[model samples]
Target: MVRIREDDINEIRNKAGIVDIISRYLPVYRKGKSYTALCPFHDDHTPSLSISEDKQIYKCFVCGAGGNVFSFVQNYEKITFPEAVVKVASLIDYPLDYEADDVREKIDPHKETLYRILEDTIKYSMYELNNTEAKKQYLEGRGLDERVRQRFEIGYNPPNDALYRFLKAKGYTD
Candidate 1:
């Protein structure tokens, strides 16, 4: 769970322009000064998606899927309202210092456990890739090409007790 400040939310909202943000999801055409696009939420031959640059709002005339930046992220990504807010904040480079309580209250307890488990698994996998001789052979035997490995930034960790020391320096513990 992570906390988000109200100021961060507002900064995200302001920086995330409606036309630019929505353009990534849908093709928009200029109709006078406003832009119009086919609504992604519904099937429509005529373009009904209208966006106002001044207001930073979008609305689909065919359907009622309309709101500010936060609503757009929430509906499109199918994430929680706070998650959407955080994503937007990150996209806009807004600094956030939220209390854990705020984020914990919003996140599902079951999902939180799963998320933590996945995070730990990734850490373990990365550690094994770097430190284990058998794992390195396995990757090589699997025909893992250098191009692919470089593309993914894969590297073998030296056979030393350095990862634990590194994690400790970073203030992480198992």
Candidate 2:
């Protein structure tokens, strides 16, 4: 599901006038800050689709197809809500920031190369820390238990370029 901020919606609504937008799709005649046009959603000869510049909405007296500009685009273009939103935003040149849902799987079994690389790095660090008694004692002295060290991803490093070598072996650069 895609979600747009209310501020973006309001901005789109304010910038993209319903009178102007409906006029592009169909002929609209203004009468005292409001416009009326033929209801495009239904077969009607009489102009029943009432558009309001003040309310920023449209209402059909006969067919009752009423909503804001987004709904207008949605019904007119025959597109999804997100697609209509994109179209309306494009009309006003509004920027949209997209984000993924917070539902990441625990772990993917068929791990990719990048995932494997990160896992291998963690395992190597764990191995380095596991085999060293001095480093363990130092960490213990610093009030960090095994669980705490593991939680914060604390690693043990030898005197040389172990991490550099690890990355190099994994086909990584810089």
Candidate 3:
């Protein structure tokens, strides 16, 4: 997965017409450079949801539900930011590639340490299974391929206390 570039995001913003997208959920009427629809986030008799196609943003002016296209979809669909981006991109027939490396780099140090410990544990488990013919045969008989195993980070944990000892030796505590 690759991160969505800044230029690509701008393209999404420009291509996903605010009037067109909002009309899909509610009846929108053109009012000069903007559009208005009934506020879906709150009960209202008059149209209060204002959408600016020029600004690529929406505002309720009633319940204060407002933001750009991405945020509007996020609130309307009750989905995450990335999901909203994908939804908007799909609406405009735009392609997107997702990457988690940036998010991982921003996580707390303690969480990063836990991730490292789990990675080391997986390596240790794989090493421990190197000589276990029975386990290998079991996995193979189950129709698992080497590529699938590697992709899923599958590893064998011995029936004994080897995994615990390995973690202990690596300075991991319960």
Q: Give each model's whole-structure lDDT.
A: 0.75, 0.83, 0.82
Candidate 1 on 49-148: residue-level lDDT in tens?
A: 8888888898998788898878887888898788888877766666766666643556787787667655554565566676667777787888875566
Best by lDDT: 2
**Model 1 steric clash pairs:** 3-98, 130-157
Flag regions of model 3 displaced more than 4 Å: 1-3, 99-174
Candidate 2: tens digits of C-alpha lDDT, residues 39-150: 9999989888899998989999998899999899999999878778878888767787644255445566546656877777887887899889899898899999899988
Per-residue lDDT tens digits of candidate 3, residues 1-174? 336678877788878888888787788988887789998889978999899887788999989999988888888899877778888989888877767564556668788889988899899877766668888778888987677777877789878898888888888878
Q: CA shift at 97, candidate 2, in angstroms?
A: 3.4
Candidate closest to the true structure, highest TM-score: 1
Error of 2 at 101 (Å): 9.4
How well does candidate 1 score on lDDT at residue 12? 78
Considering lDDT, which of the candidate structures 2 and 3 is the better prediction for this target?
2
